[model samples]
Target: MLKDNYGRRFYYLRLSVTDICNFRCNYCLPDGYQCGESIAREKPLSVAEVNTVVRAFASLGTEKVRFTGGEPSLRKDLVQLIETAVNVDGIRRVAITTNGYRLASQIDAWQRAGLDQLNVSVDSLDPQRFRAITGHDKLANVLRGIDRALELGVSTKVNSVLLREHNLAGFEQFLDWVKVTPVSLRFIELMRTGDNRDFFASNHVAGRDIEKWLLHTGWELLPRGRDAGPAKEYTHPDYIGRIGLIMPYSRDFCAGCNRLRMSAQGALHLCLFAEAGIDLRSAIASGDHRDLAALIRSAVCGKSAGHQLDRGFTGATRNLAMLGG
Candidate 1:
């Protein structure tokens, strides 16, 4: 297994297939935001290059791969990428994190392509609030996508970012809706990234407060015996679904961090808040698999202990969308 100097084993890769998105989320990007000229002109990695990167990670003990993006469904060959990742020598599962705007139409094709899990981002259950948050009128479509994924037997999870008075006020409604669904709901704390730093000052809600409210409102705190990524999960014995909180800023889960993030442009981010990255695109384009694997190992071994967000440090210059969310 690929272990960092901190003794954290690397077994998961969050690969961004594209930086283009269909929504202009209030907390993800500024209003009227457009793709930068450089990003507009640059091309994303081809399926062949993505396949080679996945193979290299699989050889280095990567067991789980999740395709993320501004919206992964926007990628034309996403199903093919899922298939490629799932077929990698040591990969056990392949999943995606999407906005679900275009998912319902392609869910079956994704299943056939060997997708094992889905994490759909749906911030508000209220259609009006949803439109206000996402700057889109596709809440109905997203709901349909979620229901279809559940109906099709896909292990689906809904992720909502807590935006203080904005979507946080809708948590009760969200939980009520989840009780009838076959999927879990996770509330993610707003990170103060470069793209949303201004909004963070007004909208960021601590995940602990959200968890406290959940517990106070009849939700039972379940013991998370082992690491389950960054989310702290809970459940209601009577409810069919689970609830989770991802608090990157309020609570640092770095000791258990075991994943690496590869941007759509091919930069390998060792830490989400780190400004610097290794240009794996150049390495992959110029080197052989063995050399690429060596570079990956070297990069992982040098992963930082934790991000400096607690010290009033700002996050990466790129927005969550650009960083694959």
Candidate 2:
């Protein structure tokens, strides 16, 4: 098993498939994605490379792998990528975190390709606010896609970053939606990144406040699964859905970290807020599982205990889009 020096068993892998996002949220890509000559020159990992990488991780006891991106769905071969990961011998779960741009039109194909879990970013329930936050006016389309996934019995989750000035006041709408949606309604705490310092200062909202309110309202905390990502889940008898919080700034947040990130460029990231990554491009391209595992193990041995995000140390990540947070 991929156990770190801190004795944390790594069971999940967050794989970035691309770095081109369509959303320009106030906190993330506010000015829009800057697609330039650099992007044209450098391409993301190919299907064969991803297949080899996933196989290595699966061999090392990684059971769950979540595909992320500047919008993973943006990749035309995303279904092929999903199919590749699902076919790996020991992988038990295949999931994706996307912005839901093509979901309404393509979720059926994804479900057919063996995608079992889907996480869509829905910043706000209010249509206008959603547009303002995401710089796109497609809340209705996304909602339709969510319904389609539910019909197909895909485990779905809706992620909304808590923006103090944008969606905090609309919390009740989210709570009400989850009351009947039968999906995990997750609120992600806004994080400080290299380029989003000013935005983080003005918009960050603590996930703790929502937790307090949840407990007071009869929501019960539930235990986390070994292979689950870092979400503190809560459930209530009256609601079909569950509530989850990803509080990166909370004390000892990294103590429960069980996932490792691998950039689309074939670099291993011990922490999302890591200052640097160990390149594994050659190993991945060579399709040598042993070589890849050895490099991965070496990195895991020296993994930092925590991200220290509270200290204002934003590492190599200029924005969440860079790491698919």
For lDDT, the strongest prediction is: 2
Would you list the C-alpha lDDT of every candidate in the order shown? 0.82, 0.92
What number of backbone clashes does candidate 1 have, counting pairs of residues 3 or more apart or in separate chains? 0
Scored by lDDT, model 1 comes in at: 0.82
Which candidate has the top score in TM-score? 2
**Alpha-carbon RMSD, candidate 1:** 1.9
TM-scores, all candidates, are 0.94, 0.98
- lDDT of candidate 2 over 147-242, digit per residue (tens): 999999999999999999999999888888888889999899999988888889899998999899999999999999999988899999988999
> Model 1: clashing residue pairs?
none
Which 10 consecutive positions of candidate 1 have the poorest summed lDDT?
A: 221-230
| Per-residue lDDT of candidate 1, residues 1-325 (tens digit) | 7889988887888898987788889888645357563554558878888888998888888888889987888888988898888887888888899998898899999999999789999999899899899988899998898888888888998999988867878878987887877677899988877666678889988888877888897888766532145777888877788898888876557777878899888889898777776788877776366778998998887788888777756556467887666
